[model samples]
Target: MSGAAFETIASLVRTRAGIVLGADKAYMLDTRLGGLMRELSLASLDALAAKLRAPGSERLAAAVTEALTTNESFFFRDGKPFEHLKRVLPRIAAARGPAQKLRIFSAACSTGQEAYSIAMVAEQLGLLPRLEVLGTDLSQEVVRRAREGVYSQFEVQRGLPVQMLVKHFKQEAGQWRVSPALRAGVRFETGNLLADLRHLGNFDVIFCRNVLIYFDAPTKSRVLSALADRLAPDGVLYLGGAETVLGLTERFTIIEGERGVYAPVVRMAAAG
Candidate 1:
């Protein structure tokens, strides 16, 4: 692909999905979009870029965006976050009155493992009766797979404890399918973090981990602010270990003794 075509494709992805593609990512663009070209019957990357440049090419634009978006995820990814959650679930549950539902959002939930992991934790804690887990991602394909609750043996093996796997999943045709009880009360949706998120409602916990590294400063701040708005008064926000709100926004303050856990600054102030 020519420099101009690469720039155009990068710009389209950044504008549409808030994912930054630096000059070094040209190879990634070529490799990912190369498949799209074959699927669309386009002869070259330049031809695919031309389709993207055409007016009323929303379909092509979406295809490019989906093709470029990273969907890397695994069950119980990063032990610390899940460990913190296990420790804190009781506190979150205790804060609410009896029979009140607790909502958890797994933002950028690639293929639904993180959300289901949360469900598994809740189930182990005997909190599933009052818990609701929602997993959202930029890719509709992943969200659909998440809803299906099927995983290859390899996918189930990653970060999924053997005991939990045995209890929460059943082997079916060489793939592990989430148990009906474990699948209960968990939902998945396709959404963009950079867009309006008011419809997602407030959450007791928001797991927006490992996704902010893709955005530039302005977009990162915008997304963090939006997440702050969606957090309930005492809600906790879990960011990637490398991501932080310290320099991004004052709406959240890192929880003491927690690696990726945060609470609304106002809530911290009130408690103080």
Candidate 2:
């Protein structure tokens, strides 16, 4: 691909998704976009770029953005976060009044594993009756798959415990399908984190893990601030190990002893 073609595609992706593709990722563009090329019957990457530049190319632009967005995820990824959740559920439950629901948001939740894992854990702990797990991703394809609650044998094996698997999944035609009871109250929707999130409502726990690393500093700060605004008082946020709110925004502070967990900062009142 010519330099001009590369830049045009990269610019469209960044504008549409807030994902910055550096010069080193030129090869990634070629590999990821190959399928789109074939789907569009384009002769080369340059042809695809030309199509993207044409008028009324919103659909093509969306295809390119989806192609570039990474969707890698597994059940209960990075065990520590789930472990912490198991320990803290009682406290979150206690804070809620009778019949009140606890909300958990799995932001950028690719293919729904993380959200389903949380639902499984809550069910195991007897908290599923009062919990709602919302899994959102930018890709419509992944969101639809997540809502289906079907997983391949390989997908089921990753980070999903054997006992839980036996208890929560039913094997059908070689794929593991999440039990209907386990699927209750767990919803999946297509959403962009960089867009307005107020309609999603406040959450007691928000898992925006591993997604912020793709954004530039300004976008990161803006996204974090928006998350903070959506967090209920006493709510907690979990970020990826490599990501943090430090120097990005002052709206949150680390929860001591909890790796990757953060709480909204509380400012003390002035002395009388």
Candidate 3:
């Protein structure tokens, strides 16, 4: 690929998809695109990259975006957040009254584990009855898999407790699939965090974990701002352990409990 073409595509990808591809990631991109290149009948990553750069292959850009997107997820990833959820579920339940309803958005939920982990926690905490779970991603392929609610044994093995695994997922033809009752509570869709999220409605909590680390500062700010908008007034926002609300937006106040989680300000006046 031409240097200009690589730079142009990288810029467009970073701006539109919030993906920061540095020079060191050239090897990573080649590795990730190998399958795509083979399927596209291209001889080289450079050629494949150039083909995706061609005009009228706009959908190809979406495919490339999907290729570059990382989707490593598992049940209750990093334990602490779910532990916090367990602690707060009852309090949030009381705040919610009869509705006792909860909305959770697992941004960039790969396959289904992270979102399902929330479902398991909700069920275990007795919040399953009226829960609404939305797991969104930029890739259609992963979204479809999340909707299926199926997982490989290796996927299930990581981060899942033995008893919960036995309770929540059932083996069907060798693959472990989340049960109907549990699966019904969750929905998956393709979405762009950089775009308007008004259609996603309000959510009591948003788990946008592990994703922001891949973006630059401006993209991070833009994503955090959009997430803030989709978040309900009293809702909480959760980021990956490595991520924080620091310097992103002033809309949220960090909740100082169990290693620093964030709660969105119900009132702008209070936030300031």
Candidate 4:
């Protein structure tokens, strides 16, 4: 990637995705955009960036965004979090009841693993009806793969247990695959955390783990606060174990159990 093109695309990404790619990330850009160039049958990264910046090129912009969006994920990536989810399930189910569903958002869900993991747990607990899961990402490519829900053996092996491997995924001609019934209540969409999430609908629990580190402090604060606003009063927020809500957003209250968790700070709406 040329210096000018790199600057332009990096600026566009930071503006659109809230990700700050440093000067050292030039090599990464070259490696990634090279693939994008080949896939689109384009001449070069410069041409690709020009097309991205061209008028009436929403598709090109989306392609660039998806190409640049990070897609790292695995099922039950962290054991403690899923363990915590199990304990919280019954209480959340009782609190939500039948009329209202227990909505969960896996923000930055890379390849449907987190959303499908939640679905499997909820179904196993007989809480699927109480659960409606949505997985979202900044990349159109990732969201599309997530909707597909097919994983290779190596992909499923990461953070997945042997017992679960036998139970949830079936061997599809030697490749591990998620069952259809387990995926019935999930949806995936392309969304940027830097933008308004109102159109994505409200969620009772949001899993935005390991994503904020890529953002600057101000960007992280703004994004977390917005997520807090969209959260239900009693909604729980889950972040990576290495991450915390302290000093970022006062609108969330940290809850400690097997591992720590964050819940929305409940406020009473004014009576008319």
lDDT of each: 0.89, 0.90, 0.82, 0.82
Could you tally the backbone clashes for each prediction?
A: 0, 0, 0, 0
What tens-digit string does per-residue lDDT give for candidate 2 at 1-272? 99889989999978888988899989998789999898878989899888888899999998889989999999999999998899887789898995999899999988999998999889878899888989898899999999999999999999998998999999999998998886896999899998999999999999999999999889999999999988887888999989999899999999998788999876577899
Where does candidate 2 stray beyond 4 Å? 267-272
Task: Give the distance in Å from residue 21's predicted Cα in candidate 2 to where it truly belongs.
Answer: 0.8
**Order of quality (TM-score):** 2, 1, 3, 4
Model 4 weakest lDDT span, ten residues long: 252-261
Q: Write the per-residue lDDT of candidate 1 for residues 68-152, one digit (tens) a residue.
A: 9999989999989888889888898999997889999999998999999999899888999888998998898899999999999
> Which residue ranges in model 3 land beyond 4 Å of their true spot?
268-272
Residue 172 CA displacement from its true place in model 4, Å: 1.8
Q: Which residue pairs does candidate 2 place in steric collision?
A: none
Candidate 1: residue pairs that collide: none
For all predicted structures, in order, the TM-scores are 0.96, 0.96, 0.93, 0.89
Residues 1-272, candidate 3, lDDT per residue (tens digit)?
55665676577678668888887666676777778878888886567667766778787787777887898888888999999888876777778877656888988888878888888988988778878899888889998999988888888899899999899989988899898878877889998887888899878888988889989888888788888888877677888888877887777788875444788766536553
Quote the positional error of residue 259 for candidate 4 in Å: 5.1
Better of 1 and 2 by lDDT: 2
Better of 2 and 3 by TM-score: 2
Model 2's number of clashes is: 0
Instruction: Give lDDT tens digits, candidate 4, residues 1-272.
Output: 67778887888778878888887887777677777788888887788778877789777666676677778899888877787888887787788767788889999998999998899889889887667899888877778888877788899889877787788778887677777777777888877788888887898888999998888888989989989978888778888888877788788878855344888888778999
Error of 3 at 78 (Å): 0.2
Evaluate model 2: give its lDDT. 0.90
lDDT: worst 10-residue window of model 3: 263-272
